[model samples]
Target: MVVVRGALVLSLVALLLGLSAGPATAQGPKPTIVLVHGAFADSSGWRDVAANLRSEGYPVQTFDNPLRSPAYDSGQLEKQLATISGPIVLVGHSYGGFVITNTHDPDVRANVYIAAFAPASGEFVQGLLNPITYPGSRLLPPALQLKLVENDPTGIGGRNIDGYIARPYFRDIFAQDVSPAVAADMFAHQKSAALVANLEPSGAPSWATVPSWYLISTQDRVIPPALQRFMSSRAAPGRTAAVDASHASLVSRPADVTAIVLAAATAVQR
Candidate 1:
């Protein structure tokens, strides 16, 4: 009787160990992070952020938006989201914000907006940028200004180059937290699309239903700081932080952006 009891106890222990070391336990679910890049930018813009997220054990992927019409872009993004089998965290930058807002999937765990747009229902990018037209815009170096204008008519007209330079206009607008080298790299690689100009308004806002967190760049030059605040106020009233950087807070302040995303991911598990 004593031997039989001892044998039973040992068997129970072995069973428990096997369960704990099961194949299911060995292969854990991979956390998915889908990054959406904004206008005048591409997936390359999130290169640093994506690398940082990966170093920390995340399975990160970025959607290369054509920057076409908003609906067209959103449709493409949704197709990408469909491929993700598990819960996902969607991160959007600049005009990419509108894309996330429009393509938000119910399966997504959360939405993270980094110095990016968070348009409301029935609102478009123009609606957000038009309301905050400020006084004399920042000044840019004459040569650089001419480059921006000459190569891109979308830039401040032929005459506004100086005003476009002095104030850290475009660079500050997108990537304030990043280094000069990174920011310059971002600018050089920047690609503007005519479709971006035709992006339509958003129909249903993802933030209204999904958990959202916003990282507002206080020193932003492109999408005025006030405008970012307003967007956050309406879209993510409770989950917002003011970061002391320019527009590209994700690149400049990668840790903060990652923290916000990590917290959101944690909540999804609950």
Candidate 2:
């Protein structure tokens, strides 16, 4: 009787172990969707899109972009990426695209660009804008009305520390399609990006190796729709879409942005 009882106990342990491991093997791991915001905007810009993704049962994470420079920002993001296990679908907005381009975490399965700066290897944001001469191009046309803040503590020969869009032009330039009330609020809380960040060259572009999706904002005045199209063409073939929204499309058109993100997440699952 003792021998029979011991054998049964061992079998029960094995059964329990098998059951514990069953789900992981049968369904695999789910990919986490990470949303990154760009210059002049905080993580709050992704609030709507994040909510949409969460409603669909996707684990969503929104990172606060340093907006200091691509290398520094990407380094911070890399540390965050290390904490997440399984696959990742990285989505970037505006200057966040440059940050994502510099990050090549192996767990990243796909990259999504939303009215964002998609720089090639060694290409800086300013360099991309040098050739664009569109009528409503915010970067040019009497130059961006920026309030430059100095970084020097002693206040002697201090270089420009950061650049904030002048409140008066923020709505017309960045969020023309958004409502006046929301645009006013957005302008009020907007953050300043280090002026040097735009001139900093990018490292190897992750989109070159990872699958990518681009959502060009047709009415984008900041990056310009023409520039968006040119960048989208260099991405993985046939992985592009467009929306007739302003530069803040992620905020103004959250549903469309969420749909594209979900498509990337689905692709990663397969």
- What is candidate 1's lDDT per residue for 197-232, written digit by digit as tens? 334678788888887878787887667788888788
Q: What are the runs in model 1 whose C-alpha is more than 4 Å off?
A: 1-30, 131-173, 176-179, 195-199
TM-score list, all predictions: 0.73, 0.83
Error of 1 at 270 (Å): 1.3
Clashes of each: 21, 0
lDDT of 2 at 235: 70
Per-residue lDDT tens digits for candidate 2, residues 1-270, read 001122233233224222121211124355899999998788878888888777666799988887888998899999999999889989999999999999989999999999988888888988787654533467543435445566743223664567767777888889989889988888776887887788889988999899988888999888878888888899745777778899999888887787677666665664
Model 1 lDDT-worst window of ten: 1-10
Model 2 stretches with alpha carbons more than 4 Å out: 1-28, 131-136, 140-160
